[model samples]
Target: MLALTLSLALGTPAQAQDADVHEPSPAERARPDDSVAGSEKLLLTAGVSELEGAAGGGLTPWAVIGGYGTRDQIGASAFYTRVNVPDYHLDGAGALIGFLDRIEFSVAQQRFDTEAVGAALGLGRGFTFRQNIIGLKVKLAGDAVLEQDSWLPQLSVGAQFKKNDRGAVLEAIGAKDDHGIDFYASATKLYLAQSILANVTLRFTRANQIGILGFGGDRNDNYTAQLEGSLAWLLSRNLAIGAEYRMKPDNLGIAGEDDWFDAFIAWAPGKHVSLTLAYADLGNIVIKDRQRGLYASVQIGF
Candidate 1:
C-alpha cells in the first residue's frame, strides 16, 4: 500500500511540471493600462492655454480662454477686438497671464468713439476714450475633466479691477475726473458629457460704463448682478455651433441707455483657433439707437 501512494505522488509532480512549462508568464497575460501607460503627455498638457479670448459682445462674459499653465506654473496670451455700432464704435486690445493654475493677471485697453454724438455733447469730432483694466482670478475647486467620473462640474471664482482712462473727453462729459477701479466677482461652472455642451456663469460688478462717461445719476458704486450662459452642438470633428445670452444692468440715468443683451454664433475650427460673428442691441446710449451693426474677433493660441 505504501509503494502505491508514493508512486501516485511522484507521477502527479512530473505531470504538473510539464503543464507549467507550457503555461504563459504573468507579465505576458496582463493587459495594457491606457490611462497610465499609453497616454500622450503633450496632449494632456493642453488646456485653456489653447483657446483664444472671448468674441462678439463686451457685456457678455466669455469663458476664461487660457488657463493652460501646469498645476504649479504660468501661461500667457494676447488678443484684439473691434465693435462697430450704428452711432459709435470701439476698439480694444489686451493680454493675460495665469499662474499656478490657481491665479491669473490681465490688462486691457479700450478706445470708445462717440461719433456725431460727441458733437452734440459739445465735444469735437468723434471723441476717443480709453479704459485700462486689470484683473485677478482664483480657482476655488473642481477639475475641468476627470476620466474616472462623469457627475462633477468644473468651478472657479474670479474678480476684475478695472481703471477707466477717464481722459479729458470723458471728464468733459461729466465722468469722474479721477480714475475709478470697478470691482466684480464671478462664479463659473461647466457641465461635461452632455449632448449640448453648456456653461453657466454668474457675476456681480460695479461700474458706470452703462452710463456714458460714467455721468448718469444714481450710478454710484453699487454691485449689479448679471448672468451669462452658452450652449454648443458639435457639428463635426472640428466644428461647433453655439449661442450666448447676457443680461446686463440699466445703471445709466440717461434716457436712451438701459438694459440690453447680445445674441451670437461662434465657431471653433480646431484647438488653436476660433471665431465669432454676432449682432448686438445696446439699447440706448444717449437718445440715440445703440445697436451694433456687426461684431467679430479672431483668436489663435498654442
Candidate 2:
C-alpha cells in the first residue's frame, strides 16, 4: 500500500552472520527481565515507523504507541524507507518519540521522483515533489498488549499536518492547496495466544498522493473518509508476515487513482533494529500505470 510494510523478513534467518547482533547494555546484563520500559514490550510489539511516521504496520498507523516504554518511561526511534516502482520512486525518513506509552510525536519528510514520467508531463525528467509532515497521537483507551483477556482493543487518535514545497507546480495540476491536515482514529488488537495482530483505521483526509501532489483537488476540495487495515501473523519472536490494504480517493480528474495493497515480511533480529520488505501495488500514478514494486525499510532505536 504505499504504507509501512510493517513486519516480515523472509520468515527465518537463513544465516546468522547476515544480521549484526545487538550488544546488550550494562543495565540489561544485570537485570534481564527487569531491564526497564525500553525493552519490556514483547519483541515487535512496538510497531515500525509507518510511511507517515506513526507506529504501526507498514502501510497504516495502528493504535499501538510508537515504543516499548510503559507509563513511567520514554522510548524513541528513527526510520528510513524506500519504495521503487516502474516509473517512480519514493523515499522517506522520520523519527518519533513516545511519552509515557500514551502520546507520540513524530516528524517526517518524503520525496517522490517522477522519473521518465516527469518528461511525459512536460515537467522535465526526474522531476521530484517534496513534502514534510508533522504528527501527534494520543491513546484514548484500552491496551492492545497487556489486556489480552479483555475484548476491547487499543484505541488511539492522531493527526498529521503536511506541507508541500512545490506549490505552483501542484496547483498547475489541479490541486486546490499545497498543505492539509489529516485526522484518523485507529483500533488495534494483539492476540498473543493466536499469534495474530489486527488493526483498522479510519482517516479523514484531502491530500493527493499522500501530499506529494499537494492537498485537495479540483474534483473535491473537502476532506473525505478512507479506510486502512492490517493483519499480521507472528511466525516467531523476531519474524512476522502480514498484508495491508489502504483505500484512497480519486481526487484528480486527470489522473485516476486506485486503492493500494501489499504483502510484507518483517524481521527484528534484536530489540534495537528491525527490517521490513514488501511487494506493493500502488495502482497508478499521474502519468504511469501499474506502479508495482518493492518496499523496503529499516528502523533503529530503543
Candidate 3:
C-alpha cells in the first residue's frame, strides 16, 4: 500500500507537467515572430555601407539586404565615410532602411573637395562638388545565409539615382547631363563552413567620376556595362578582411578615368555598429594620376 501511494504521487506530477508543456507547430517554428527590432541575423552577413548608401563593400553593392532584420522584421542603419587623397577629399553620409529582409531604400550625399586643383582650373580654391544619391534594392532569389546546402547564391537588383549640383562646371567640362541613373545586379555567396564570402556585380552606368564630375561626357555619352567584384575572408564572427575591384568608364577625354581597387578590413563589434578602413587606389581623378588614399567608414544602427 505504501509503494502504490508513492508511485501514484510521482506519476500524477509527471502527467500534470507533460500536460502543461506546449510544442510549437512546424509552421510556427519556421517563421518566428520573435525576430522583431531587427535582431537574429549573423554578424557581418548584411555587409557595410558602400559610398552610395547601399549595403555592400567599400565601393560596390552586395546581394544581401541592409541591417540585421529577418523575414518578419524591419531594420535601419546609417553610415558616414571619408576618403583622403593626395590632392582631394571625399565625404559621404547616408542612411538605409530594410523591410522584411527583402527590400532596401537608401539616401546619400557626397561632397568632393577640389583643393588646389580648383584654382588651377579657374574655379575657386576651396570649390567643392556636391552630389545626392537615392538608392533602392530588391532581393530577387536565393538566400546567402539560410541556403548553405545549395549552390544557388543570393541575387539582388539595385538602382541609384544621382544628381550633381555643379551643372555649369560639368557642362564646361563636356559632361552631357547633371543628373543620371545607374542600374546593377549583384550575386553573393556566403560559404559559412569555409568562412568566405564572394560577390559579383554587373553595372550599367554613364556616370563620370561616379557623378562628382556629372554623368556622361564628350568621349562617351551612352550607358556601358561595367564589372565590380569583392572577396572576403572572415577571421571571426566580428571581423572580416576583403578586397574589391571596380571597373569604370572612361567617358571624359580631358581627364582619363581609371579602374579602382581597394583592400579593406571591416569590423563589427556587434550587430548595431561596424567600422571599415581601407587603402584605396582611385587610379586617376582629373589631372592627378595614381590618387592613392585612405578610406574610412563607420556604420551604426539596428
Candidate 4:
C-alpha cells in the first residue's frame, strides 16, 4: 500500500512538470514580433529613392534630391570635380540649392588649363580660361518612385547659361571675342532601378570648346546635339560600378571628332558624402590626340 501511494504521488508531479515545460516564457513570446516590427520601419526609412550622380553626363543634369532630406521640400548640395589629361586640366566647384522640391538653382565656376603640345600653339604657358555656369531646373512630370509602375519617366527641364572669361585668353590666342554666353537644354531619363540601371540623356548646346585658341570653327554660335549614356550595377549596399559613353561633335578643324568613354566606381559611406573615381579616354582635342587620364569628384550635402 505504501509503494502504491508513492507511485501515484510521483506520477502526479511528473505530469505537472511536463505541462510547465510546454509553456513559453514571457520574453521569448515577445521577441519575434518585436523584431519584425523593427525591420519594417528600417525598410520604410531607407528605400531606393536617393539621387545617384550630380550630372546627366560630365555636365550636371537635373536630378532629384537624395538621402535624409530626400523627402523634405527643400534641400542643398555642393560638389568639387577635377579632370586631368595630357593636354588639358580642369577644376570645377559648384553648389545646388533646391526650392519646393520642384525647382533647383545652381552655380559653378571652372578653371581650364591648357598645355602647348600641338601645332603652332605658342601662347606663353598655354592659356588659362574661366567659365561661370548658372543653371535652373524645373520638374515637369511624374515622381521618381511613385510613378515606377507606369511608363512615364520623372521628367525635368533644365537650362544652363555659361559665361566664358576669355579676355586674356582671346588676346593671347589672336581671337577677337572676349566673352560670350552659351545656352543649352537637356532631357534625362532614368530607367530600371536597383540591381541593373540605365540612364539616357540628350543635350543641345552652343559652345566653342572644340575650337582651340578661340579660332572660329564649326563650334561657334552653332547648336550641337549630343548623346550621353550610362549603365550601372549595384555590387552591394554602399558601392556601385558603371560605364559611360558620350557622343560629341567634331567642331575643330585641326583634329578628328571627340569621342570618349569612361569606367567608374562610386562609393557612398552614408547619406551625406559620396566619392567617385574613373578612368577616361579622351580621343583628341586640337592637334594633340589620344588624351587619356583620371577623373575624380567628391560631393557633400545635407
Top TM-score model: 3
Model 3 worst lDDT window (10 residues): 12-21
Model 2: per-residue Cα lDDT at residue 82? 99
User: How do the residues 1-302 of candidate 3 rate in per-residue lDDT, one tens digit apiece?
Assistant: 56556756677657655655688898867954675676667888899999989999999999999988888888889999999999999999999998889999999999999999999899988699999999999999999988999999999999999999999999999999999999999999999999999999999999998899999999999999999999999999999999999999999989899999999999999999999999999999999998999999999978
Model 3 sits at a Cα RMSD from the real structure of: 6.9
Scored by lDDT, the top model is 3
Q: Which residue segments of model 3 deviate by more than 4 Å?
A: 1-35
Model 4 lDDT at residue 20: 47
TM-score of each: 0.69, 0.88, 0.90, 0.70
Residue-level lDDT of model 1, residues 1-104, one tens digit each, is 56545656677656555644657799899975433212121211222211112221234433332434555445555666667888888776676665655566
**Native-referenced Cα lDDT, model 1:** 0.51
Q: Between candidates 1 and 4, which one is better according to lDDT?
A: 4
The TM-score-based order of candidates, best leading, equals 3, 2, 4, 1
Where does candidate 2 stray beyond 4 Å? 1-37
Task: Give the Cα lDDT of each candidate.
Answer: 0.51, 0.89, 0.93, 0.55
C-alpha RMSD for every candidate = 8.8, 16.0, 6.9, 13.5
Which residue pairs in candidate 1 collide? 48-66, 256-284, 257-284
lDDT of 1 at 280: 62
